[model samples]
Structures are given as structure tokens and as C-alpha cells.
Target: MSTDSFDPVLLEILGNKFASVTEEMCLTLQRTGRTLYVKETADFACALAGRDGRFFAYPRSIGVSGFVGLECLPAIEAAVAACGALEPGDVILTNDPYRSTGLATHLPDLHMIEPYFDGGEIVAYGWCFVHCSDVGGRVASSISPVNTEIFQEGLRIPPVKLMRRGEMSPEVKLFLDANSRTPEANMGDIRAMLASLATGRRRVAQMLSQHGAAELGAAQGALMDYAAGKAEAVLRTVPEGSYRFADYLDDDAASRLPVRLAVTVTIGGGKVHLDFTGSDPQVATAMNIPSCGRPHAWLTLRMLALVQTLDRSAPLNAGLLRPLSIYTPPGSLVNPEEPAATGVRHAAAIRVNDILNGAFGLALPSVLPAAASGTVIPIVMSEPLASGGRMVQVIEPLIGGTGARQGHDGVDGRDSGISNLANNPVETVEAELGVEVLRYGLRPDSGGAGQWRGGCGMELSFRILSPGSHVLGRGMERLLFRPWGQAGGQPGLPGSLVVNEGQPRERRLGKIDVLEVEAGDIVTFRTPGAGGWGNPLDREAEAVLVDVEAGFVTPDHAKAAYGVALIDGRIDAETTARLRAAQTGSEGTVFGPERDAWDSIFAPEAMDRLNAALLALPLSRRQARRREIFETVLADLPSAFPKSPANAAQAEAAQRRLETCLAETS
Candidate 1:
């Protein structure tokens, strides 16, 4: 049977069945999983993949939402080539990003694939991955942004059978147990994954019994084709032209210099091509994205978001990526070479999503929203136990608000731009770990000011109750450049970390490696707010008053940002009218004061030329040479150069010095 002969109604039914199977698998994994990251934060995902290795059915409301496009074929092929053809009840496991052809993105994300057989022939594969607590690395949780190579990140499990012929492989289990800091917890999650795969296998067999093998195979292709058509229709709505945009990570964890990500999206004839040509070279830190030059999930997540946003009923599968093509420059941040650490690749992916969002927004201004709070920090705590061991668990998955759109305000204290992870409840955190939750709530006046106000950021303050405890806040970003606003809207506030709120012993820090703390030390994490849409003066005074009442925007902020005066909890229309008349509004994307100052010295054109020259050199020399040029140019400026804008004479000298450096490189 071919897709042409398959009935539409049957295809829809099969699509629902396939989706439900994956969701059931997810539920099983979550219900039986051990770690806080798995059970509470839901950093795991389950999907059904076709024989070609691409996912045909993915869960909608569970697990990580951005990995629908991941390919499982490479790992499948690698396992088959190494250990011969797969038999019944064989499960292939791997966590090596490079070895698995980008299937397993990082060390902690343990990916497994189990072949489902019908009449002694393989029909579909069940796939699932969990972000394990530890895989044995230099740091406590096996992920540190400062790690320069993949070997230091964690244990690299190749594509081998963790379970063969319905029996667990003791050799593989032994190696896994020896390599992880949380061996018992890892095994518990592994068992949960096995249960998920078994659940998927049973569901596939039930579907086969109902629809027969031939019709089931045909429905897989037919459903994908339907989704592809819907995605193409959405792409056609976008204007036929090239839209270019770029954004930055605050800095590589090893250095203070920022990392750049550039993208040029071309949409024409119901197809989109993303060219990541001007992105910076792969960094020496763990912040590199391991895309392997394919249209990886990390590189093209925004396109998935766009199609889903336009066509709500489109099926969740690899077909959504059919109309998209990507070109990530070799050795660039998006396509790092082998052995480059990818422990925190999601940090770079968050910025990649921003650039893609910005480029697409240029084409569909009314459809796409302003920038989101571009950060996701998984604040983890490692407390000492009485048995001379350490207890490691995630405290909270911190994130800010989503960007405001043309007609709708952004969602406050919740941004799913990257991973849609749920925060650990305050009571759960206190119960699981040795900490007192001081405050967990939204920050007032954190969102950008506009007609449709941006979402406010979150604040988490806690005091350590255990002596000699350590805190790990990985993926911290948006400290320098704010989340940019659109259509003359103001930029959002940047993120900050404070050791203590109002004490002389307070010590403010940027992105940390591994922070050591003692009992009574209070730690606070404030995430960046999202960018707003349209001019603030155009926002209704009543809307500002409502925001003030809800504690999202303070009374003084309402007057300052939106030009609305609140008197006795009521909007003063007369005062608001005067303030609006006096206030001036700017047009186009507003990148706030910090970006404005940085752009004055290191302009886009200059950076492009510099990167082009640097990319021409050997990979080993790119990072060092690039660092030298920046250091020489910034020698005469203040220590905090970009944070504090340079003087007129200083800016001129820096620009001239940059020109000379580029000329010499040429």
C-alpha cells in the first residue's frame, strides 16, 4: 500500500494513535523516573521514529518539545554495523554527541532506541532520552561551561546494546555504573526508560494487529506528507526575501568576550533556507552547538515554532522540518568539530533561537513576537550527606517571560522559547534538599515597556541550611545585552546574581563555574525580562494600571515606561496625556542602551570581516588569534568597556585600531 491509496480518515486516526503511544511512553517514564530533572523538571522525551531514523510521532504536551527533528538512523546504523543486525528485544544506547551523529547532544542526555518488530521485520523504533544527574566528569553534575574538550564533559557511551535479546548486558551496565556519580539514580531512570520502550513496543503491536502491517507503514508516510503540506502552506505566507539577524551570548564561560551567532533566512516558493555564515567560530568552552552540519534540531527550532504557531493542527513529527534547509558553516559555533565540549550546548542554542526569531520577525512582523528572555539556568545544589557522600539535585529550572506580540502581551514568569521545563515547587525543593526558600516569585518592572508589554522575569532567593554546600548555575546568560524589543518598544532588563541582598558580605557575580557556600549564605537569581512590542505611549493607560495592580509593573515604572500616572490605584488620564505628549518614541527594533553602546565600537560589518579572516586560518589558531585582536583593541578603554560606553575620543581610537587589525589579518 502506498500513501496515495491510504484514506485520510484512517491516517488521522493512526496519527492520533501514534502520538498517544509516545505520550503514554512519556507518562511511564515520568511516573517511574528517579531524578528531580526527570520527574519534576521533565527534561526527558519519547518519540516513535520511522525506519529512516526520523521521528514520525512525538509527544505534544510532555518532554522536551524542540527535538522532534532529531535523527535516530545514525545511531541505529552504527549499532548494526558494530554488533551485526539487531535481534528481538535489543536496545541501542549512546550519549556521545559526535559518535551518534548528533542524536545524543550531550553526555548527560542518555538516548536509547529499541526496534519494534512485526512478523520478524522491523517496522518502527521507540526512542527516549533522559538528562541524567551525572555521567562522571570534572564537575559534580558532570556539566561545567569551562570544560574545553568533550572528554572532560563526561563518559562517552557509544552506540552499543545496553540490552540484547531480552536480557540486560552486564558489561554495559557495569561500565555505566562505574562512570556516573549518581549510579543508583541513573539505573533507576534507565529502568524507567526501559519501561517506556516496552510500553511503546506493546502499543505498536496493538496498532499492527488492528490496521495490519502494510496500512500502518503507509499511514506513517501519509501523515508526514500531510504535515509537510501544512508546513509549506505556512511558509508560503511569509514574504519571499532574505531576512538577516544576529544575537550574542554574554560570554564563553572561560572568558569575558561575547560569542556571536548570525543567521540569514531566505524564504521563497514555499521553502526556507537558513545560512549561518557570519557566526563566530567554535569556542574553547562547552557552549558550542554540535549540529554536525545537518538541519539539527538546535539550528532550526524556530522554523518548527513558526509552522506550529501558524497551523495549530499540524502533526508533531519530522515532516515539519521538510520545507526547511540549513547551512551551518563548518567549525562555527553552530557546527563544532569533534571533541569540542557540548556539555552546555543549550546555552548557545538559546541565542540561536533568538537570531532565528529576529530574522523571521523581519518577514512576519505582526506574526512573530519581540525577543524572549533569552536564558535558561538550571540552578543545582550539591549538599553534603552524613555518609561522606554528596547529594546532587536541581533546585530550579529558572526562566523569564516570553516576548510580547502585536496584539497580545507576553506570558509572565514563563518562557518556553528553548526547553519547556517546569520549575520545581518551592516546597519540593525545601523537602528534597537542605535549603530554606526565602522568596520565589516574579520581579516587578522587569518586563520591557510597550503597547503590548513583555513578560516579567522570575526571582529565586534561598538560604543554605547545609554546611559546605555547593551551587551550580549553568546556562546563565543575558547579563550584558538585554532581550531586544520590537517596533520602537523598550528593551527588557538584564539578569543578575547576588550572594546576599543587603549585607556587607554580599558579593555579586557573573556566570559562575562552581560556587561554594556555607550555612546562612543567601543566594539570589533574577532572570532577564522579555522584550516588548510597539511603542509604550501607544499602550492604554488602563492596561498599565492593571499591570500595576497585578504587581507586574510598579506605579513608578508605569509612569516612567508607559507615561501613565497612577493616583490612589487609579490612572490619572490628565497627567498621562501630558507625559505621552512630551515623550519621544523610536522606531524599529530597540536593543537597549548596552547593545547600542557595544555596536558603536564593534560594528556588524567589521565583525563579519574579522570572522571571515579568522575562519580562513587553521582551527587550532582561530580562538587565540581572535582573542588577541580584541585584547589589543580594548587595551586603552576602561576595564568595563562595553558595559560603560566609551568616550568620543576613545570610541574613535578603538574603531581605528579594529580597522588596522582587520587590515593586517587580510
Candidate 2:
């Protein structure tokens, strides 16, 4: 049966039914889940895949949001090739990124697929994944950004049957139990996933009974085709041209050298192709994205967000990716080799979203917003238990705000560009871990200044209640460079990490590996604000007063950044007018002072030429060569370098040295 055989009304109804089944599965998983990551953070997802192994239906409300486009075919095929054909009661489990061809991007994300059989023939598949608390690796949570290779990140679980013939496989269970520090919690979450799959199985069986196998199949195809058409329509709205943008990870977790991610997005004939040709080579740290040279979810989530933002009625499925194509260089940061670590891939993925947003904004300035906060740090704390083991739980999945658009201000203290994870409540966090929540709110003046102001960043401060505790902050970023602004707007402030703020022995830190803390130590994390949309001087004085009164923008900041002066509680009209008249408006994109300083020395064209030359060398030698050139150039400048701008002569000398080094290397 073809999609043409199904009426539009029937297709819509079937689409709703399929989506409801996935939501039900997600609700079931969340209700039965044991780990804090699942129950509170909602770091899990459920989906229904057709026989083609592409998701036809995925949960919208509950669980992680950006994984709708993940493919299950590779894992399914691997299982079949290894352990024979799948039976009705069999469930395949895997967390090997390469072995499953990017199905499980990292080790902690345990992915499972179960076939839904209809009358002895496979009709659909049930898929779900949970971020296990521990999978036995170098650290307490099995995810350290400094892990140099996949082997140090965690245990690799290739596609194998976790359950067979309606019975749990003892061999698989034994291996899983032995590897993790939190075996009981992992087992509980696994059981919850099994229950979720069962829910999907039953729901699909009901749909099959209602519409029969052939009609159900036809409806599935029809729904996806409808979504694909909608996606193409959205793509066609973008002008046919190549828009290039690049962003950077503050540094590889193990070093001070920045990691760059560049993309050239070409849109034509209702299709978009992303060429990641100028991105840096994969680093020795765990921040590498494991795309397997495919348009993986990490690399294409911005496309998904763009379609949904324009057409909310489009169904969430693989069809939304039908118009998208991607080309990631073999050993680049976006598509790393097999042994490259991926424990903290989300750090790099967040920057990918920024570059994609930047490129698309150039194509359609009014439709897309400026850069978002571009960071999501899952702050996990591990406290020692009396049983000679550590109790690991995520204190919070902290994130900043969205970017401002043409006619609106950005949302404050919340960003869903990547994972839309809900923050764990203070009470729940305190109950599970040894920490006391102190101050949790928005940071005033953190957002960029513009006609439409960017969203404010977040602040989280908590006091440790247990000594000898270890704090692990994965996905920490946006420290060195601020989120860029569009049009004539100003860039947002950079992020900061402080321990025991305002007290003796206070210390400021960059990204952390595994920080040890005492009982009375207080930890504070202030995330970066999003970028603004228009010229700050063009903003209304009344709007600045409103922000000042609401504490979103401080009085001094309003005077300095927005050229709006306030006296007592009211705006001083004369002073504000005088201040506004003295400032000149900026044009185009504003990448803040630090990036401006860095770029003055290492220009984009120069870096592009250097990267092209570096890519020609062997992968083993690329990183060292790139580092040597950068270090030699940075040697003559101040230790702070970009954060502290060099004199004209110093900068010119550094540029000459960079040129000479590039020529010699070439």
C-alpha cells in the first residue's frame, strides 16, 4: 500500500496515535526510572521506528528533545549480524559509538532496541535510552572530559541481546553488573527502559489491530512524507547561497589551546548541505563528537530546531532530516575516529548549534535569532557513602537563556537549544546528595545590550555538606569568548566559575576536571548570557527602566551598555539622552572584545589556510603541528593573550611569526 491510499485525515489521526504511543512510553520510563538522571533530569528518550529503522514517532514533552533524528538501523543490523535474527522477546543493548555507527554517541547513553512483531513478522521497533549514573570508567560518573580515548571513558557494550525469549539474559546481566559502580541503580533504570519498550509494543499492537498491518504501514509513510514536505517548504524559504560561520570550544579540556568548529551551509533547491571542511582536528580530550561521518543528531539539531520553529505543526520524526545532507571531515572534531573519546561530546555540540544558528541568521536575519548562551553544564557531585562507595547524582543540569530576536527579548535563565532537561529541585537534590542550595536565580546584566535585549544568564551557588566530595562539571564552556550578537547588537558576557565567593581562600577557575571540596566550601556557577538582536542605542528608554526595576539589568549597566541613565528609581531623561548621543553604533556581528582581540592576531583566512595545510598531514601529527604553531606565536605575548590585548607592535610581530610558521609547515 502506498501513502496515496491513505486519506489526509486518516494520516493525521495515525500520526497522533503514533506520537501518543511514544509519549506514553516516555512517561512510563520516567515513572519507573530509578536514577536521578532519569527521574528528575529526564535525560532519556523513547521512540517508535518503522521497519526501515528510522524513527516515525518520538516523545515531545518528556525526555531529551534533540535526539529525534537518531538512527537505529546500524545497531539493529549489528545485532542481527552477530547473534542471528531478532525474535519477538529479544532486546538489543549497545553503547559503542562506532560499533553501532553513532546510534549510542557515548558510553553512558545505553541504547536499547526491541522489535515489535505482528503475526510472526516484524512491523516496527521500540527504542529508548537512559544516561546511566555509572558505567565503570576513570571517574565516579564514568565521564571525564580529560579522558583521552574511548577505552578510558567507560565499558563498551556492543549490540547484543539483553533479554531473549521473554527471559533476561544472565550473561549480559553479569557483565553489566560487574562494570558499573552503581549496579543496582543501573539495573533499575534498565528495567524501566524494558517497561517502556513493552508499553510501545502494546500500543503498536493496538494500532495494528485497529487499522490492520497494511493500513498502519501506509499511514506511517504518509505521516513522514507530510513532515518532509513541511521541512522542504521551510528550507526553500532560505535564500539559495552558501553561508559560512565558525565557533570554538573554549579549550580542549586538557589544554589551553582552543578547538575550532567551522561549517559552510549551502542551501539550494529546497535542500541544505553542511560541509564541515575547516573544523579543527579531533582533540586528545573527550570533547570530540562521534558523528561517524553521518548527519548525526548532534550535527543536525539546529536544522530540526529551525523547521519546528517555523512550522510547529510538523511531526517530529526522521522525515524532518530528509532535506538535510552533511559532510564531516574524517578526523575532524565533528566526526572523530574510533578511538577518539566522546564522554563530553555535548560541549562541542553546543558550539555546533551556535555556528549553525550564526550561518542561518545570515541567510534569514529576521527569522533566526542571535547566538544563545551556548552552554549546558551537568554539575554532578559524588559524596562518599558509609558502605565504602560513592553516591553520585547530578546536582543540576544548569543552562542559560535563549537569544533575542527581531521584535522580542530573549527568555531569561533557560535555553532548550540542545537538551530540554528540567532542573532537579533543590529539595530533591539535597535529599539525594550532600549539598545545601544557597542562591539560585538569574544574574543581572549578564545579557547582551540591544534594542531587543538578550536573555539573562543563570547563577547557582551551593555549599558542600560532605568533605572529601568530588565535583565533576561536564559540558562547561563559553568562558573565553562571549556569545556573539547579530546586526548592531552587543555580545553577551562570558561565564565564570568561583569557589567560596567573597570569602577568604576564594579561587576563580576555568573548566574543571574533578574538583575536590571541603565541607564548608561554597561553589558558584554563573553561566553566560545570550546575544542581543539589534543596536542597544536604538532601544527605548522606558524598556531599559523596566529591566532596571526588574533587576534583569542593573542601573549602572543600563547607563553604560544601553546609554540609559537612572536616578533613584526613574530614568533620568537628560542624562540618558546625553549618554546616547556620545556613543557610535556598531554594525554587523559583534563577537565581544576577547574574540576581536584574538582575531586581530589570528585572522580567519590565515587560520583557514593553516587548517587546510594541517589536514594534509597524517592524523597522528596534525594536533602536534597545530599546537606548535599556536604556542610559538603565543610565546611572545602576555600569558593572558586574547583576554589582554597586545600592543600594535606586539600583535604585528605575532602575526608575522604566525605567517612564517605556516609557510615553513606548508
Candidate 3:
């Protein structure tokens, strides 16, 4: 290891300093960034990459929904090719996910790469990215599930020199200014990213002064190797075997059909191979992954993480990926082809997590936790008030319970498969908009029944105190298939939202737009519950009693979900014993964890193949491409197919019209 070639102690200190420098850089960006997703939501990331483009050190947790996959090498190389040479003061910007690989998924995700210089030579580069508010497109928010092509999604900027020498480029500036719906917000985010780059430059210089440039370079490579070693050790712990998992995309938004992803994970002798051979082809929609057949690290970080979690000693680094191999056939969802709208890749990724869980469960059933609530629907509802025109607002970001582990019941009302973002406070929601939050708490009967009952879901209801308003609900999934349970557990409830004028016959709206309504319209949203662990009757009476007092479970649900009867606030010990001993009926059969189901489907190779097939379809036939693929898969699942064929056929026809309209402009 180059780390050993140098002074180990010095390299360790330099490594610590490198991490500190990048962290401080992120802190600075958050303080200065303009958008709410930045300043409020904290969706951003900053890191110091070695001159080689690989991150020597990256944040463990911070910023943006999913950016651990982003890299600066390609963008930097592109800039050098364009400008002939990159000076000390130059910085590059690119949001083209296809060009940057895992770097930037969509246009709003602005990435900046700056070269760090030392003694007239380049040492490293600092990088940062944020999902800006807009980049000029068909919608107010630059991202939309309806976008069939990248062009409709937003302006695509390949890796380009945004700065030259010491000044911002005039052409870059003019182009950016013209292409954004929210130009001011985009510029604010860019400035924040640029500031982070400057921070990387400064801290890198400090590390060089202490450890010397050569040692710093050596440490970067060594650290990566060390991480790989740790990951391998972790892989060795899992019982060597091949595991299969599968998951689904609720829909491509343009079609009612659900997309399927299947993966088979082969892990043995410290190696992991992800195969996506039978997975469906790519879609015409933007909800695709742009991996280009290459096994991008971001695509498989969770698998690595699951291994690391099982083996706590495993180090985080690119080396961890060495033992991991992926097979993503072109024209699939996990690896999309040219111009397949990929505005929302995370939607597909969420399912990928499930597939890995299933495969891991097959290999190490006792070690891993059960499936989570299985979906994250941050439902944003907007409306207009009496004195002012209506605007959009997030009523609440709905989240489900966490999956139950072997020894513990799943956590209620908290899970972060995507971004472990904190839910907005109900008080904050009420204060910012004309709404009164009525119910914001756990869903009592929603968790799947099991030995250890599944965690309860949540229900949030509010009244629009003002008049006309609009609602935009993104990231909504698992509304049909309830969150599954594990062992002998039950499934959680699906979520729903309805608007009414104080009557039972209210209205349920799908992906909404501007709406007119009076002051008394009430909206309620319910999130799913987590799966359970073990058998319901086997659960200890004390645990059942505790739940009764917690209000998360009631006496009726206790008996129904767990077969534990309550007597005077205490479990009827004698009756419980009798009931427990008599446990029977189809009600007792556990649904198992959803992680078991989703994990079964979205294995690494499965995603690779799925994405590759999606990418193989030429840009022109993307909509029809996505529909046929998802429709075929959904046809098999009677209980699971979200898109009714009749409607999907209609939407597929409509998507072509929309794609044609977009093509004429593109």
C-alpha cells in the first residue's frame, strides 16, 4: 500500500484532515445555498477527489438524495479536451448523467469540478453537487414523471468549462441564464458548489504541506485498497451462495404498467456478481438508470453497505467494489440507452434495495433485517388562499415503519432507503401554508401481523384554510402492494390522499395540478407500515403489553395482529397462553419481509441487464419501449400489477404523442 510506503502516522493525519476539509466545505455550501432542497432539505454533497478522479475521501452522510456515485474525472477530462489546458483557476460544470456516469443524474443536479494545484503541478480536485430548482423545461419544477425525453425534462449540459483562468465563462453564463425556470435559484446553487471547490483546494493544499504531495497521493490509493480489503472480509462472512431477488417500478408515470427488475446475486470466496439477464428492457420515460453497461459504484453501494453492515469492520472504499462484478444488459432500466428520460433514477433504485435484501436473506437469513415499509411518498399538496394566488406546498413527506430485525421489532414511522432526510415538522407545514394539520400520527391497524407485529404506519390530515390551490405528489410508490412482513408476519396498509368539502364522498386525485376549492377542503395522507419478525403467538407477552400502552397498538389490533388478548391493560396471560397455543387460521401465515420480495428482484446484475436493455432502445421508440417492457412483466402479477391494461394502452398511445411533440423541438 502506498500508505505504508509513506509515513503511516503522517498519512493517517493527512487523511483525517482531508475529511475535515471536505466536511467544512459542505457546511459552507449549506450556509450559502439558495434553494430549499439545499438550505432546508440539505440535498447536496462535497468531496476531495485525487488527481485520478476517484474520491480519496467522501462524506459518510450528507447532501443530495443520491450522489455517492458522482465522479469528476470525466468532466475534468472533457474540459481539458475542450480548452486544451486547465489552469489553476478554472472550474468545470456538467449535469449530464450519461457523460458523467454516476456523477450527475439529471440537469438540476449541478456538478462542479476544480483542479487543486501545488508547486505548478496538479495534485487533486474538489467536487460538489446540488439538485437545483430548475433548468428550463415543461414543468414549474424541472423534474416530472411525465417527461418522456430528456429534452422535455430540462436543458442538458455536457461537461464544459464554466470557468477559465480566474473568470466565469460568458458562454456558460448566457446559456445557463436562458435555460432555467428558476435562474436565480440555479445560480445560487452553482455559487455554492464553486465555493465548495475552493474549500477542497484550500484543504488539499494544507494536507500537502503536512504530508507532502507524494504521501498524500499514496494515501489516496492505499485508503481505497484498505476499503476493498475490509469489504472482502465482510463478503467472506455471508454464507457463500447465490441469491435471487426482484422488485418493481410502480409505473413509468407515462404508462399504468409496472416495470419489473430481477437479479441473481452470486457471492462466494469474497466475491459478488450481480446478473440482470432476464430483466425487462428499458423505458422511454426518464425513470431510468444511465450506467452504460459499466458497473458504476453508485449502482451497487447498498449491496456493499449491506455487506459492511453485516461486517462492521469493513472499510468504505472503491476496493470494496473489486470483488463485486455487475452484468447490466443494454436497453434495460438499470442501464438506460440514449435520451431515455432519466430524471428520476432513485425511483428505480428504491426497488434495487429490496432485491439485494432478498438475495442477502437467502444467504444469511438470521443476520439481516426484514423488509421496510417499502416506499417513500413525499406528497406535496398546494393551493391558493383568499388574499393571494395559490402556490405549491408539501403537506407532508410520508414515510413508513422500519423493518424488524431478528432481535428487535421494526422501528415505527422512520426509514431511509433513499435519503435519511428528516420529515418536515407538522408545525412548519401549517405555518408556511394555509392549512391546519388535524391528524399526524401512527396508523394503528396498518402494520403486518406477526410474532413481533410490524411497525404501525402514519396518517396525516389537513384542511386548506384558503381557496384555490395545487398539489404535486412525487416519490409515491407501494400504494397497491402493502408493505410485506417477514417470518410469520403480516403486511402493512397502503397510503391514500383525498380532498373533500366536509363530506364522506370526497375526491381522490392522481398526480395533481392547479385546483380550485373552498376553505374547508380536507386532505388526508396515510403511509405504509413495516413488516414484522417471527410468529405473532411466539412474541413475548411483555412486548405485547408494552405495545398496548404505547398507543401504537390497541387491544383489538393486538389480538388480531398478534393474537395477544389484553385484560385490564395487561395481557390476559392465561387466555394469551391458550390462544397462543391454539394459533391457527390463514391469518397466522406471515407475508415475510418485502425486502425479501424486492431484494429477490433487483440484484446487481439484474439491474445492470434491465438498464442496459432500456439503454439499447434507440431514443425514438422510448415510450413504446418502456410500456411494452413493463406491461409484459406486470401481466404475471395478478395482485401486483398497478397499471390496468386498458388504461396503460391509452397512456402508451398518449406518451407517443407527447414524445413526438418533444422530438419536434429536440
Candidate 4:
């Protein structure tokens, strides 16, 4: 092997070594973490940043891939400014989105940065973050959609030094302990974060020892270039042009009103640009994405996995973003300004992924897949069984279907568009809390009707064996906009929740808060289904008959949705012929008109521009700006907020807000 180009085998070897280092760091944190989200679900990320503050190696399939572009430079700089000197035992803590320039979007997510030294000189930093239990302040859980100001949410730690030259800071510890609902759990998570930093520091130190400081630094640069090359190659494969896609949030959690996301993806040669020009402005709610107009956690996701997973050896760095650009106007949902409450940025990110998928599908028609179940639902239950004794039970984070890619039908009842977390076992929930698991199975025939039918969602039911319990479920997406299908495939069913003794009083609950339940209260949760892949009528006769026999489609729905008549588990010849004849003229996706209306106004150009406008306004005015934008579009429509099953009164009220905002913006 020549030194001029270096051996390809050696490059592969060093790449895998760095990859293992990050993976091991994750394992260490997971082993020590106390929270179920960390220990069980794995909603965390770990990475190694170069001296310049950009990550060189990020885990591809583990943790949240969107956080790969986070810069530790800001937090490091803040620590140096606040604490005069640094030592080996020192670690910095921060979750102030504005201070970190959007790196730590929410309060519950604690971010820590540690500097690693080589020959007495600081060479690089190791960074990690985990979603902890609580941080005290306003709400009982510390995070709610209603929290507009940072002071109301929880403790906002600037880059205060958590560890000073390797010793724990008592002052910082005191503040943390005083401000959290579960101080012990928070502290355990903190220790986990510290452990993560130490792991990264050790790994970096090891690489430095073996390769020498200069060679390690050189490797970082080389790896970044390599990622850029691989990413560009993927870009070139996407036929040079533009593709657009849009999705929505059910509501801001404060009202019945929905939020929209529209994206326009432009690809030329090897570079891609994501323009979120027409999305709603940042709202008062916590769902804003604090991007700072660069490739933020929310924006970098599509490219991160697309490049790295396509080539596992691609450098785990922002260099993948080197050949890509994001155009999110400041103050929009994707790029909110300072003091904008961003506790739920991932809520917006799920929509962003859908948008990217839609756009990419247009360019790479054969390569891309249809829409998925498109939501992450965590069935949270808090029970105080015996008089005043409290226990929290997370049944499981219920997810829906994965999209059907070319040459394959979509997978049933599983998705990872956001953080690909695992579902909690029924046994685990029952073992820990005051509840008995009733049902943990798939919802039969809940998927949309199509030639290449979408995947079905899930149904989870449980009985509160003890009294005085509080039940909460959140992170639910695709409840408003049914996950759309491509190339004439039909959309899927929306989700719902019911509470009762399996009777008519089993209410279709809206997105909920803590609900008090007594002994014998039976609760059932039905997740949404995935989108279909092709024209339903074009579906095979045998497939339709199978759907009927399997209880996936009713005899009536088989005739309507698939345009087939299945009598005695066999398709009627005349009906099949008519269905085929009717397919000659139909084109475009088959999502309902309600979804179409939502998608139109919240287009990519509109969203990017709206967010940019929001960024200019003070943080206090973000909600007002967003509400106004949506209201303006709905003012002229007959059924305002089309996604909702609206009546005249609701439409009038929606129009009032829209008309008022439109007039003001004008």
C-alpha cells in the first residue's frame, strides 16, 4: 500500500475504531442511567468532536441522529468565560437554547461538554445529552406546552461549570438538587452524562496516544472530507431538481388548532438545499425547532442517516452537511430565536422527516418509499394506588407503521422517524406499577386500503387494578394529517384513546393531560396506521380476499376502498373488471381533501419565510405570529383548519384569528 493515498483497508480500520469508541460511550451511559428513557428506550446521543467543535464520528443507527451537528464550542466558550480556569476534572452544563445558540433546545435535555488534553494542550471535546425526568419550577413534570417563558419551564443552566478540574461543584449540585422534582433521578442522569464525557475523553486520549496528536487531528479532517464525498454521491443519485412535501402537528397542546410544515428540497449535482420557507412561525408552544439558521438537529437528520447508513464508514461529522445547505428563515418553527420555548422540537422534527421523505421521493421515485404510520405515542400512566402513594407507569411508546419502499410493502406497526426508541414490555409495566396488562397486540385492518396496502397500527389496553391514578399520553403525531401514500396509494386511519369498562362511555379522548382513574378503570389505546402504496382498485384479487379473511378490511370497505367485492373469500369477477377499468384515469396521491387543504397553505416556501419573519419578532410575539399566519389562510376556507372535523362555529372562530393576523401582518 502506498503512503500517497494510504491503504483503503487501513482507512476502514481506523474508521471502525472511532465508531466503536462512540458506541462504547453510549453503552457506558446506558448502563449507568436510571431513567427508563435512557436505560430502556435509548433516547440519547454520544459523539466525538474535533478541536474545531464539529463532530467527526456520530452513531448512525443508535440514539438521536439529528443532534449530530450540535456545536460544543459555544458551551466551552461560555464555561471559559464564567470559570476563569479549567482542569482535567471539569465539566460544563447547559440547556439554554439561546445561550448555546440552539444546541440545547429544551430545559429537560441537559448537555455537557468536556475538554480532552494532549501534551498539556486542549485537543478536542466530547459531548453528550440525555432527556432527564425533571428540573422543578412551574408544572409538576416540569415540561408542558403552556410554558412560554424559560423561567416557567424549569432551571435554565448557563454553561456553569458542573465539575471544576475533575472535582464536582457543590454549588452547582445544590442548585440542581433544589430545582428538580426528582432530584435523585436527575443527579443519576447527570452522573451518566459525566460518565459519557469521561468515556469520550478517554477514547480521544487513547487515539492520541496511538496515532500521535497531529495524526489524530489530520484524521478528523480526512474523515469529514470522506463523509462529504459520500453524501455528495447520494445527492447526485437524486435527479437534479426540486421536490416538496408537507406534514402537520395535531395541535399546539394549548388549543385544537394545528401547525403545518412545508419543505422544498432542491438538489443539483451533489449538493442539496432544504428550504422551509412556508412553515408556520414559531408558536408560544414548546414545539419550536431552535436551529439558528444552520443545519440544526432538526434539519440535519435526513442527510445524516441517508449518507452514513448508505455507507456505514462515512465520517460521523457535519462534513456530510458540507455538501448540503438548509434555508430555514429565523423565527419559523424550524429556526426559532432566543427565549422561544423549544421543549418539543422533536415534535416538529418528525414532520421535517416526512417533508424530506416526500421531497426525496419525487426525485428518486423508484428508490423512495410511501408514507408511514408517522407518529410516536408514549402511553404514560401515573397511579397513586394506596391513599396518596404515587407511581408512574409508561406502558410503552406506541408507534405506527413504517412506509412501504419500492419492491416491498410497508412494515406493520413500527417506525423510527424521530428517535427510534423501543416499546416498553407489558410485563415491565405490570411488574413495576399498580396496573394489569389486558391487551398488547396489533389493531387488525386499521391500515389504509390500497393495492399495496399500508401497515396496520397497534392497540394496547390495560386495567387500573388500584385507584387514584393519573394517566398521560404524548408525542403523538399523524393524528391530524393521515400519513399520505405515494403514486395513488390511500392514506391511513387516525389514532384514538378510550377509557371505561369496555362500554359506550369509552370516550375518544383528545390529546390528554393527567386523568384521574379509580380501580377497575380499563384504558385502551389505538395507534394510527401507515399509508398505502398504489391505487386500491389495482390491488390483486387474492390480496383483497386475504384482507377480508384476516379481518383487515370489512366486506363493505373492500368494495369501497379496494373497489372489489369479496364474496366467500374470493373476488367477484365483474367487480374486479370494473375496478380495473376505473383505474385508467385516476392519478396523484389519494390522501383526503382535509389533508390537501392543510398541505397547501403550509408549503415549504411559505414555512421558511414565516419562520424567518418570526425570528425577527421578539420571542414573546412568536405564538401570536404563528396563530395569525394559520388563521389568515383559514379565513376564506369554508371549513377552517380543514384537518379538523369543523363546524360553522369553530370555522368562524378560526377565521377570526386568521383574518386578524393576516390584516396585521399586511
TM-score of candidate 1 on Cα atoms, chains taken together: 0.98
lDDT of 4 by residue, 370-423 (tens): 777777766666665354434443568788877665556677777766567777
TM-score for each predicted model, relative to the true structure: 0.98, 0.98, 0.84, 0.87
Q: For residues 620-645, could you state the per-residue lDDT of candidate 2 as single tens digits?
A: 99889988999999888988968999
Prediction 1 global C-alpha lDDT:
0.90
Worst window of 10 by summed lDDT in candidate 4:
67-76
* Between candidates 3 and 4, the lDDT winner: 4
- The per-model lDDT (C-alpha) reads 0.90, 0.89, 0.67, 0.72
lDDT of 4 at 522: 88
**Model 3: residues with Cα > 4 Å off, grouped in runs:** 1-8, 64-84, 380-397, 427-436, 465-468, 501-505, 509-520, 585-666
How well is each residue in 576-638 modelled by candidate 1, as lDDT tens digits? 999999999878999988788878989998988988898888999999999999998888888
lDDT of 3 by residue, 129-179 (tens): 877666767665566666777888778888788988869998899999888
Candidate No. with top lDDT: 1
Better of 1 and 3 by lDDT: 1
Q: Which stretches of candidate 4 lie over 4 Å from their true place?
A: 1-7, 65-85, 308-313, 385-393, 501-504, 543-559, 563-586, 597-664
Per-model clash counts, in order, read 0, 0, 67, 24
